[model samples]
Target chain A: MFEKLARMDRRIIYAVVFLSLSIPLIWPIGLGVTVGPETKELYNTVESLAPGSAVILSMDTSPGGYGELASGAAALLNHLSRQGIRVIGMGFFDTGPSLLETAFGGSDFKNKQYGTDYVNLGYLAGSETAIARMAKDIPGSFPRDYRGNLTPELPAMEGISSAQDVALVITISSGTPGVPEWIRQVGDPMGVPIATAIVAVNVPNMTPYMQSGQLSGMIPSMKGAAGYESLMGTSGLGIRGMDAQSISHLTILALVLLGNVVYLGTKSGASRGGGR
Target chain B: MRRELPVALAFAVGVLMIVSFFFTSEPLVEAAKTVQNWGVIIAAFALGLASVNLIQIHARRIIRGKGLDWLYSGALIFSMIGIALLGIVRGPTHRTYQFWFDALFVPGQATVYAMTGFFIASAAYRAFRVRNLDAAILLLSAAVLMLGNVPIGEKIWSQFPVIGDWLMNIPNLAGQRGMLIGAGIGGIASGLRVLLGIEKSYLGGSSS
Candidate 1:
């Protein structure tokens, strides 16, 4: 039994994980969710933004990272719309603008006027340097909006000369030229507040920034998305996806535990057949 | 002359950028801005250069490769050119361009990323053994974090979330902050090396 268990086919693991994920997704368990302090702070920060205030929403993620971050971005954008804060959207990643378009369409921004309440300033080519330039001169960085409209002509961009004109900067991020770039370029130097909707892998690395208050707040991974969703009194992908996320976590834990148990059993046996 | 000119240019540009960042001198700031704009234009050209490089490498594969290697390369070349043309003619915001992006590219990349979850699970199970005291601690911490981040963990034990937060905020932040500070200092040291022309690795050779 130990030998067979030790050499189990990898396909079994795949099948089990697929089922564990799919079942919860199909019929969500609706487990009770407790909002963390960081998530609540992000909610409160957005809530505190006054009407007509402009915020920079940079979609600095690729399609892969976008898949994970889209839920939180939608929820945050929805909240931003509700508070009547104008959003000036742009992307450091080339895929950012298209994802921004998707985000706006899926959120309440679609109901808001394009040039007034929100606008997509499209993508800039340079990575960190572009962000620095944008911080120094927002209009110069993007003269034309994603749809080819003049940026200065847009109502949402009025008086938005530099990063200082915006109330806050939020990045839905995955890779390089992301949160750290924003911090060095715009946040710390310009005294502009920065926040993020980041993937799970990066959450640990970003905690120090959060602790130092360099990041005003963050929506971390899908759980953070769910917390933000609950705070908003709305249901979307974040809330629904939590069930699958929880199950998958538990499944991985179980696999680790089971493997340890097998290891112990094999080690304790009378004579190991030349060991594992 | 070949190497000296490039190194001198690098030193001058580097010093100029550092000076402009710290001071409010108008001419220095303007020069830095122009240099940054040049960086942006170069980055845009780099994208085009990358596409050409991809085509060159894949075209070779299609010509000389056997079996399905050519097929895969052909598909890659086709998609790259097709998408570039579509975006060029109709703009990236056009529905047809977005359609191919959303229908094919997004899902393809997303699927590749999602598959890592399964791989991680299998790999962790096989490899995460308590071989020593450090390994035991690592495994224990991983277990705690995994359970704490999920709702089901709270259902099992209410204190799991609290412990998780404490673990992350205290130890994780402390370690992360140290690494960040160390990295920041290291970056400055390296920048100084390159600016002073003591590091000539960028010129494809060791420091002289």
Candidate 2:
């Protein structure tokens, strides 16, 4: 029995985990979220943005990370919309513009008119170099918007020529040519405040930047998304997913404990047989 | 002359970029901006270069008609050209392109990412045996972190969140900083090697 238990097929473990994640997602337990200090800082930074101030929302992730970050971006967008801040959307990744379109289309910005309240400058081909050029000359770098309209004619592009004109820059990033790239090319060089909503895997790597005061705020993964949603008084997918995340975590921990127990038992059993 | 000219250009450009940061003179800054713009243009061209390379490799595979390789190669080529033509004709914001991206591409990527959860669970079950003190500590930390990052941890015990935050803030931050600093130093050394023409591997061959 012990051997069988120890040698349980991985398929069973996968099934258990899938159920652990899926069931809670279906019927959520609505766990109360404890807001992290970083998430709170992100919320406060956007809140503190003066009305009519423009902020660059750089969607630098593809769909791989979009699933994890979309809710956080939505919550942040909702907050930005409430504050009536102008958002200039741009991306370094090719898939960035499409992700931004989905984000904007799904958010409270549905009612907001494009070219007025918000505008997407589209996916710039160059990664860090594009960021540097945009910092120097925004209109020069992107002559046309994502929708094929001239950028200078857009209302949101008015009075916004470079990074200096913007109040803050928020990068929703999954990988390289992202937050660090932004900081190196635009934020640090131009003295613009930068924040990020990144995938959870990058949280530890980015925390030091937050500590060093390079990043003004950060939202760490889906849990941070849930915390931000709770603060906004709007329960979105992030809040919904927390139940699943919690259950999955517990399930894995239980599995680890069980595996250790089996290991110890097997070792002791072998020792006793040897003694006999 | 082939290597010397490229190395000299790189050395000059690298030095100018470094100088632009500290000096900030108008002409120097403008010159740096021009170089940066050139970099962007070159990067844009590199995308086209990559596409051509991808097509060439896939086209050869399809021509060879190797086992199942041709099928995948054909699919890849068709998808690439089809998507590109669609976008070129109708623009990316058009319904057809958006539909393909949103419906087909997004979910496919998300599904691939979501499979990590199951893999993690299975891997943890098989590998996280507490064989030694280091392994035990690693297991305990992973468990604590997993619990603490979610809302349920606070429910179980507030201290979990507190301890988790400490783990991330202090030790994690220190470790990450050490890595970042090390990487920065390595990058500078590599850059110097390139500038001095000591690193010719980037030129497609070993340094003499």
Candidate 3:
């Protein structure tokens, strides 16, 4: 049975992996998570925003990354809203508009009327070029709100136009034309402090901007989400996801170790048994 | 002529777009803006075309009696067409369209993204083989970072988080900054090449 199982097909391995993931998700083990510096920087950057300061929330993620970052995005929005900052939400990704609604609807943020306390600019087609044009003229790029009303007519956007009008810019993104575009086109020229929450894969690329002070800070993936959750003192998906992430990580580590050991053992045993 | 004229236009406009960056004249800027607007409209149409292509392929598969998963593809095409119709004809303000988007589109994306939690674990398992000295170091650092990112490691040993933070802040920053500088230089160089027509990758594939 052991020998037969040892030679089990890759599908079985996949099944095991799936079970390893699903079991933890079904019954999670709560592991206390410490907030790292990147997250700390993200928290502090938001905390430091002055009331009435206009901050552009570039919710540039597809719907898929929403589950991982939505709660953190919400907490960040709620924090900004509480501070009395005017939040302008824009999406580069096509699915961004719905994501904005998801993030906003989940909290007290819904009470904040659109085109007043906050505005959703919805999806703009061009990726990086849109950010570039936006830096040149905000209304010229996004002439109307998501609802098709003239943007300038909105009380929220009355004084808000261009990157210069924004005090701080936070880009919640899953990919490119996000933080980099913000840093180059918007944050740097306008002197608006910029921060980002990127998918984990993109974090390495974003760190340089943060270091150079181009991006004031960043939240890197789920771990960054966890850190933001910790700071907000409201446990959400980031915290819950952290539990599943930890268990799954541990399981992988253990499996790798076991696989290596078994391989080495089999090699040495075969050599000895064959009269080495 | 179907592909050639558009391809020529794309090449011409693409060149003008690059050229407009250098010259500050009103005509140049206007040309650039026009090019950009055209790009946007074309890109949007391309997205629609891509989706229609998917619907065609998937619907055909279903029609040919492929498999159980063919139903999944049917669901995809149905939802896509429904949403596209809603977005185009009925408008976003309509309650039925909003309901479909909010309920179906939003959750569908979120569910797919949530799968990353599982995928990341599988990837990490494959990554930690420690095949060489470099691999060993990378594995060790990953472990330190993982432990540092979580609080239990700090409770067990405070140094773990501190070391992890240092690795991320110092070495990670150094490496990333180096890449950024290299990238900036490359980007500018490539832009110059494109402007010179020495590089035509942006013009896209050959017109054949």
Candidate 4:
């Protein structure tokens, strides 16, 4: 039985992972995540905004990571929308446009009218270069909307030229041409207050901007997303994923300890045997 | 000329973009906007072109029969051309195109996303071999996080939440912050090098 356990088929592992993930999702552990200082800072930055404050949201992740980030992004949008702030939603990547539509179009914020309450400038290409330009003259870079409507003609573009017109820029990015580019291009020079939410792998890259005050605040991956969601008094995918993430982290930690114990014990036994 | 001109052009564009970042003057900004708009159009075209390119390459490989599986290649090419023709010839609004996209594209992308399960499991298995003090800490932290995340563990043991929160907020944030600083510096340095023409990785392969 022990030998069989040692050489267990990968299907067993797959089943374990699937069951482990699905069970928590079905019956949430209701694990409370403490909203960290950074999350609070992010919340406050958006919260402090006066009504009619021009805000830009850059959704720069594909649909896959979108599922991971959807809750935080939706909650943030809801918070801003409640404030009656003017929103200009856009994406730096192609697939990002659809995800933003889903985030905003969801039940929580469905009544928000397109082009009046908010506008989607759609996916702009050329990666970081487009971001740099959009920071200056938005219409200059985005002459038209995704549907080919004249962008300058839209009410959302009223008095909005350059990053300065934006009171705050919240970019939820999964990777490159994201937070750092915003800091370098818009926040640093244009003085637009920048905030960002990014994947766990990217949190390290985003920290300096937050530290430097280039970014007003940040939501760091699913944990950060969960923390932000908790503060909003709404639990979503981010909060739910926490149990699975926590368990996975702990499982990895336990395996590491076991491996070390075996290694040390073997080493000691080998040393004593050599001495004999 | 073929390689060097494109590389040099990329270098020049990179500089212009960097300057456009700080300057924002009319000419610089206009040039930047023009370049960006052109890029958007080019990228849209590239997406379509890439699919066509993929079909051609696979079709050629199949014909040559040079260490390649012809039957599989044929199927792939047929799908590519099929989709392209459906969109271009029959129009994107046609039922055929919509059906192909919904049936093939949507599910394929979803399956790809779901495949991350295999990756995470492999990574976790490798990472969880506790060897020493740090390893023990990591192993323990991982277990706590997993238990806190999964329902059964929390159902059995209520204290999982507190420990999970601590693991994420303190150690996780610290590790993430360290990485962010390193990445920021790397990004800035890389962006500068590109602007200065010192890096030509974007110009494809070897600088020489």
Candidate 5:
């Protein structure tokens, strides 16, 4: 058994991981997650917002990271809509506006009025430069919404000319010109509270911002999405995927432990055999 | 003259942006806003230029290529041209344009990202061997983090979340803050260098 384990093929490991993730996803075990402080912080922030408050939802990720971020975006949107917040959506990434369209369709935002309750301001060209421009003059930066409607004409855009006019800025971000970009361009300079639904890889990078109060809140990756779902008392994709994520985590742990055991065993045996 | 012109422009623009940030002088602020707006338009043009560049390189590869390289290049060119034309004519919101984007691009990119999990699992099995004290510490931390991140960890012990919180909030926060501060200073230094014309690489040449 030890010998077979020692020479295990990479394919077997892959197959095991695939099954571990898939089986749990197909039939969930309900190993739900705890709502972390960051997720709660976001919830509290949104909860405190007055109705008719304007908030910018910037989609700063492509489809590659969107799969991971979509659940969190939906959860955040759910709260935003319930709070009657006026959502002014845009994307720094070209894919952002398109994805925002899809996210809105899938979310409760669909039930709300388009121009007044929410509007997609579409994709901007100049990454961080675009963000900086938008900070000073939102209507000037966008000019036209994603659907080719005049942004200034939209009821949601009324009285919200710049970042300072908004209550909060939430970026569903995955890469560069994301959280850090928002922090520098809008958050710090204008003093608007910034929040994010970010990718897992970026969660570690964002901790300091959360601690320093530079970022008011964050929904971190899938786990954060799951936590947000739990807090909302609705089981969405985030909650649905948590079982799979948990099982996968355990599966990787097992692999790592087995790996170390194999190493120790092999090393001891080889040393006894005169460094064979 | 070309080199001198771009360098001078960079310096002026950089100085203008910095000035707009610190001072609220109306003329300077308005000028900076105009420059930023122009930066956006230029960026849109850059995207178009990038597409043309992609086509030129791939078209060359398709002609003077070897083995399966020509096939790959041809496919890339075909996809790029087909999608670009379709998007141009029907608009990106058109059903057919969206169909291709949704059916092909999104899933293809998502699959590529998802496959990393399998590779990571396999790598962990073969490469996560404990060799020394440092290795053991790393392994321990990795285990704690993995367990703490999920529900089962709490099921095993409630303190898992608390410890994980401590790990992230204290040590992780400290490291991230240090890096952010250092990077911020480094970025300002580089920005100053460009503004002072001490860095001319932006003009497609070696820094001075």
Candidate 6:
């Protein structure tokens, strides 16, 4: 029995995980989610932004990260749109601008006027250096908006000459040229508050920044997205996906525990047989 | 002159950048900005170079007529050109371009990422065995963390979140900080080597 359990086919595990993740999506358990302090801080920071204040939304992730971060970005964008904050979108990664468009198009901001409530400055070529240049001169860094409009004349970009003018900077990041780059190049030097909606793998590394106050707030991952959705009184993908995440974690944990138990039992039995 | 000129340029630019950080003089700052701008231009060129290199390697594979390899190479080249042309001519915001990205590229990337969960589960089942005391502790901590991040964890035991947060805040933070500090020191050392022309690896040659 122990041998059979130990040698279970990997395909079975994959099927089990697929079912564990899928069933929850089809019929959610609707488990309660406790909002973490960091997520709350992020919510409060954006909430405190005065109406019409300009904020920099740097989409620094590719599609792989977008899968994990899209819900969080959507919830945050919804909150921002509701609060009447003007957003200036930009991307470090080449793929970021399109993802930003997709996120914005799906949000409550659909009715929001382009070039007035929000505008995409599109992708800049340089990574960290581009960020530094933008901090110094936003107009110089991006001469034209993603849609080919002159950035200097855009309504959303009015009076936003540099990073300092923005009320806050939020980086939805997956990798390098991301939160750390923003913090080093703009946030610290310009005295602007920085926040992030980062993928799950980055949560631990970024926690120290939150603790030290370099980051004003953070949405840790999809879980953070769900918490933000709950805060906003909306049911989005984040909330819908949490059931699967919960079940998947439990399944992995059970597999680990069962594997250990089998190993221990086999070892003990082998010892008794050797003694006989 | 090839090696000498490149080394001299790197040393001069590296020193100027470091000096500008400490001084507020306009000329030094301006020089630093110019160098940074040059860096950006070079990086852009490098990207073009990489694309050219990709095209060369794959085109060669097709020329060699290596069975399914040629097919894959053909597909890659076709996709690359198709996407680039679509973006350049019609713009990224065009309906057709957006549809390709949304329906095809995004799902392809998401599928690749989603597969990791299954792989991780399989790996955990096969590899997470208690062979020693340290292994037991590691397994226990992993279990705690896995459970704590999920809603079911708190449902099973409210303490899961509390313990998980404690583990992350205390031990995890300490370890991360140590790594950051160590990396910072190593970076400074590497920068110095490059600035002094002691590290010629960046110039496509060994230090020795």
Best candidate, DockQ: 2
Tens-digit lDDT string for candidate 4 (B1-208): 8766876787788788768766748898778777876776787688778877887888788988865578789888877677767666875435676566545664567568766865667455544555578866766776776565444456658788578767776777687778767887998998777766677777788643
Top-down DockQ ranking: 2, 1, 5, 6, 3, 4
lDDT of each: 0.91, 0.90, 0.74, 0.73, 0.90, 0.90
What is the iRMS for every candidate structure? Answer: 0.9, 1.1, 3.2, 4.8, 1.1, 1.2
Question: What are the fnat scores of the candidates, in the order listed?
Answer: 0.71, 0.83, 0.39, 0.29, 0.74, 0.66
Question: What ranges in model 5 sit over 4 Å off?
Answer: A1-3, B1-4
lDDT, candidate 3, B61-135, per-residue tens: 888877686888888877777787877797664678767767877787677776665565545544446567997
Off by over 4 Å in 4: A244-276, B1-25, B31-49, B61-111, B132-208
Where does candidate 5 chain B have its weakest 10-residue lDDT segment?
B199-208
lDDT of 3 at B109: 68
1 or 6, which is superior by TM-score?
A: 1
Q: List the residue pairs that clash in candidate 6.
A: none
The DockQ-based CAPRI class assigned to model 2 is high
What is the per-residue lDDT of model 5 for residues B1-208, given as tens digits with 9 covering 90 to 100?
Answer: 8777887899888888988998988898789999999999999999999999999998898899888899999999999899889877887777888778778888899899999999999888889888888988888888888788888888888887788888888888898889999999999999988888888887775666
- B89 in model 1: Cα distance from truth in Å? 0.7
Backbone clashes, each candidate: 0, 0, 1, 32, 0, 0
Best by lDDT: 1
lDDT of 2 by residue, B62-179 (tens): 9999999999999999999999999999998999999999999999999999899888888888888988899978887888898888888888988888899889988898899999
Worst 10 residues of 4 chain B by lDDT: B122-131
- Report the lDDT tens digits of candidate 5 across residue range A147-254: 778889999989988899999999999998899999998898889999999998898999999988998889989999999999999999999888888889999999
Q: Which stretches of candidate 3 lie over 4 Å from their true place?
A: A1-30, B1-35, B55-74, B93-95, B116-128, B201-208
TM-score of model 1 (first chain only): 0.96
Q: How far out, in Å, is residue A91 in model 6?
A: 1.2
lDDT of 1 by residue, B13-65 (tens): 99998998889788997898898999899999999899899999999999998
Candidate 4: what lDDT? Answer: 0.73
